[model samples]
Target: MANKNAPFHPIIYVRGYAMTPGEIDETTADPFCGFNLGSTVYRAVPEKERQPRKFIFESPVIRLASDFGYQDVYEEGYDILDPEWEADPDNKVPSRAIIIFRYYDEASRLLGIGQTPNISQFADKLRLLILRVRELVCKNPANGIGEDDFRCHLVAHSMGGLVCRALLQNPAAEFRAAVKHVDKLFTYATPHNGIEMVGVNIPKWLDMNDMKNFNRDYMAEYLNIKDAFKATGRVDWLPEDSFPSERVFCMVGSNRMDYEAALGMSRTFAGHGSDGLVRIENAALHGWRRSGKNKGSAGDSCAKAFAYRAHSGFLGIVNSEEAFQNLTRFLFGDIRVDLWVDVEQIRLPKPVQDEVLAGRKVSALYQFEILASPRGKLWYLTRRTAEEDSVACLSHEEWMQAPAQRQALYLSSVFLANRARVNPRRRSLAYSMTLGVRVPDYEVDRRLWVNEHYEGGYLFRDSIILEMVPPKAEGDAWQVKYAWQGSGVSKADTAIDAKLLGDSRMEVCVPFGSSGSPGMQGQLRFIVSLWNKEAAGN
Candidate 1:
C-alpha cells in the first residue's frame, strides 16, 4: 500500500569527532579558567558558520537550490531552530550519529559514562539517534510521517563522514539492510582515506581506550586488524563492506593557516592542503583522481572542494560558507553534471616555423619500431578489409600482434630551433627556427605511421614494418630540404596530397596543425594501421 500523501523525509545531519568531555559540553563552562573553551570548539559553533546560512541569490527558485540553514543542537545552542521544524511543525530536520566506544578495562567499562563520551560510543547509538528523529516526525503526525514512509538524507562533518562510510560499506548484510532506507549522504572533511593525526603526541591517558590507533593503520582493511586486537570476539576493523562509495558524497577542505604551535609542537600534523586536520585527499572518496580547477567531461563525476580552513579550531572548516554551499548542492540537487562537445569539430593551433625556406635544407632521416598485438590485428582487418588480399601476407608472430585494422600508423611533429639562414639578399638573420614534419609515403592515408623516411623521399617498401626516419643528424647542417608530403599519387591516396602542404608545419595557418586535409581539418585525428608481415628469413 503506497502512501501517496507521504511527505519527503527530513535531512539528518551528522557531526564528527567529539572525543573530548569539555568540547562536547553544551552547559556553562568555567569562567575564571582564563579561556572560554566553548568559544574555541570546532564542532559546536553558530548558524552562519555551520551550514550555508546565506545565499548568493535571493529569489525563491534560486533560494531553494542554494538554501542552507544551520540545524544542530549542541553546535548552535538552540537559539536558531530549523525553519522547516518551526514553519509547518510537521517536517522536522534532525542531526544524529552512532557513537561506538572502545573498551579499555577488564569489565570494558564505557568511558565518560552518562557524559558525552559514553553517549557517543557505539555506532548503533548513531543509528538510534536518527531513529529517534524519525520518531519525533511521527509524533507530529502533521508531518505526514508513517512507519514505511520515512526516509532521510545525511550530511556529516569530519569523523562523522567516516562513521557514515562504515555504515554504508559495512560487510554485514543485516546492518546494511537496517538503514538501507537512507537516500543521500554528504560529508565534509571526513577523512575517508584514513586519519594520520592520531600519530601526533597527544596525551596517551586522554584516550586510554585508543580508537585513533585503530583508524591510522587499518580503516580500509579493518577486519584483520580488529581480529588481532581482540582475544576472541568478531574482530572486524571496517564493517564488512561498510561504507560503499556509491552510498555517499563528500566535500573536503584545505586550510591555509600559518604553521603555528598553539596545539603543541609535537602534535601529528596533517597536510599543508588540509582543513586543519583532515587532508584534502583523505577527506574525499579514495581513487577520485580528478582534482584541481578542471571538471570531468562526463555527467557522473565525483564532488570535491579543496578550500582553505584550519584543522580543528574556532574558524576552521566548519566555519566556512563555501564548504556549506557545495555540500547542500550535492545533497539536494543531482550530483551528476553533463558537458558535451564534438571532438571532430575542434581545431588545433597552427604549427610554428621560423626559418626562411631554401631549395635545400640540412635535415636527418630516421626510422622507428612497431609494436603489434592481437587486438592490433583486429583493428587493421576491420578498417581495410578490401585491401586485405593484397597486404594479407604476415608471419604467425606478426599476425598474433598486428591490429585488426591497418591503422597502426605512427606520426611525429617536428620542431626546429636556431637554424641559421643564409640569404643571398643580406647577412643571415639570427632568428630561431621551427620547421616541418617528415612522414612515410607522402601518398599514404592512415592514422598510425612509423617514421620511415629514406633520404627525405616519399616511398614505402613492401615490408609490413614501417619505421620513421629522423629529419636531422647529430651535427648541425647549413642546407635544408623542406619539401615532403604524406600519401602517394594513387586514387586510394588522393586526399593525402590535397591535404599535404609539403611541410606539415606550413599546413597550419593556426598553431599545432598536422595535415591540412578536410578529413584532418577540424579533427586532428590519425588512426594507426597495423600489418603483421613475415620477417625476411621466416
Candidate 2:
C-alpha cells in the first residue's frame, strides 16, 4: 500500500554549481554533496532586550527519513543504478527513496580525469538517470506500482536547476520520453535567466573554465529558447508546452551579506539586489521585459517564495527553515494559497497630499514590504524587505491613477495541510501576514524632499491573521476569519462575510491604519486563490 502521508514519488537531488577546483573536489568527496548539510541557528527576538534563541535544523535528508520514512537509495556505499540489480526481484527500490545526482564526480580529480563536460552533457546524463530510476522502481511488481505510475520529483539547487530545465526543455528527440517521468521541479536560488556579474550578464566571450554557461546568450542557444529573449529581459527557460509552469517552484534568496564565498569577494562582485551570487530578478522563472510587460503566458508563472537567505554557505537558501517548509509543503501539502495585493487607494500625508493636489510637481516613491508566517511559527514563510529584497515601488502619479493600472501584485504562495503538521481538532489553516508601507523619500520638482517622521521607516504597518476552514458540506464555501493586529482587544474583532467567488477564489478587504497617526487610511484588497492541484501538472 502507498504511504498516504508521504510524497507519492521518489526524490532526486541535484546540487548546485561548483566554481573552483577545490569546490569541485569537496563536492565529489561528499556522498550527499551538501544535500544532507545541517545547521544550528538562532532567531532574533522582536524585542531588542530579549536574547535570540537557538534552533537546530537536522537537514532535509534527515527530516525526510525521520518524518516520512524515506530511505537513501544506496547499498554498500554505492548508489543503486544498474538494471542488473532488478534480476533479484526481491531487491526493489521503494517509492520514497532519496537519490543524489553525483554529476560533478566525473569532473573531480579524485574520481575522474578532471575534465568537466558542458551542461548539455550533464542534461543527457540526467535523462539516462531518470530512465534508470524508473526501471529500478517501476518494473518491480513487488513495489505495487505500474510502469506508468512511476514518477520522480527533481529538487535542484542553483545550476542544477538549469540542468533539470535543460532536460525538460531542450532534450534530444530520442530522449523525449524521459520528461514524462518528472513529476515536479523545485529550484533553490537558480539563475533561471542566467547570472549577472556587476551590472552585466556573464559575458559569452568569458568561456574560461566554462563560466560562459551562465551567459544569457549561451543559455538562449543551449536551452533552445532564443525567441524568449528580448533586448532587455528573457522568458523562463521551461516552456509551457514542455512542462506546466505551475509544477515548478523557485525559492529565491534575498540576503547577500551573510554569504562568505570566496572570502566574501563573490558578494562584492554580485552586488545589490542579489543573494550574494544570484540576483533576485534572475532567481524566478517568470518572464518580464524592461517595460514591465510580462511575456509569460497566462498561468505560466511558476510558484515562488522569497526568504532572507544567501545563495550558499552557512546561511544558504537551501539550508533555511523557510526553504525546507516550502519544499515539503509544495510536495505533499493538500492546500495551496496564492496571495496577491490590490491597492484600492494610497493616501499621502496631509501636507504632501495638499501639495500634490495643487499640482506642484510633487513626486513620491513608496515601497511595500510583505511577510507571511504560519499561525504557530515565529519565523516567516516568506519575507520581502524594502532595504534588502525587491519591494513593490510606486510613484505618486501611479498611485493617483485608476486601480487597473496598478493591477494586482503577487506576493507569495503558502502551502498548508502537510500530513505531519495537520491538527484534526483545529480543522483549519491559520497564517499571519505583515505588510509595511514605507515612503523612503520623495521629490518635488526634481528636487530633494522629506516627509513627516514615522517610526519603523513605514507610514503604515500592520499584521493580519487569517484562518481558513474547509467547507463541511458540498455546496458550503470556505469559512474565513480575518482580523488586523490589535483587533483582538478592540471592537475590530469581527468575522468578515467573505464571498466564495469560485471553488478556489476568494477576496477580502483588510483595513489599513496607523494608530495615533491621523489622516492615514486605506484598505488592502487581498485576492486569495487555491491553486488547482490536479491541473498543477504534478
How high is the CA lDDT of each candidate model?
A: 0.33, 0.75
Q: What clash count does candidate 1 reach?
A: 104
> Candidate 2 overall Cα lDDT vs. reference?
0.75
Best by lDDT: 2
Q: List candidate 2 segments past 4 Å from native.
A: 1-7, 43-53, 82-90, 235-237, 287-300, 357-360, 400-406, 418-422, 451-456, 489-493, 498-538
Residue range 439-499, candidate 1, lDDT tens digits = 2222112222223324443112111111111123333222211111232221111112112
TM per model? 0.42, 0.88
Instruction: Estimate the Cα RMSD of every predicted model relative to the unseen true structure.
Output: 23.0, 4.0
Writing each residue's lDDT as its tens digit, candidate 2 over 392-437 gives 6666777566744534567778887635344667777777888887
Model 1 worst lDDT window (10 residues): 381-390
Q: State which candidate has the highest TM-score.
A: 2
Candidate 1 residue runs with Cα over 4 Å from true position: 1-8, 24-121, 197-214, 221-247, 256-268, 286-302, 338-538
* Shift in Å, residue 518, candidate 1: 26
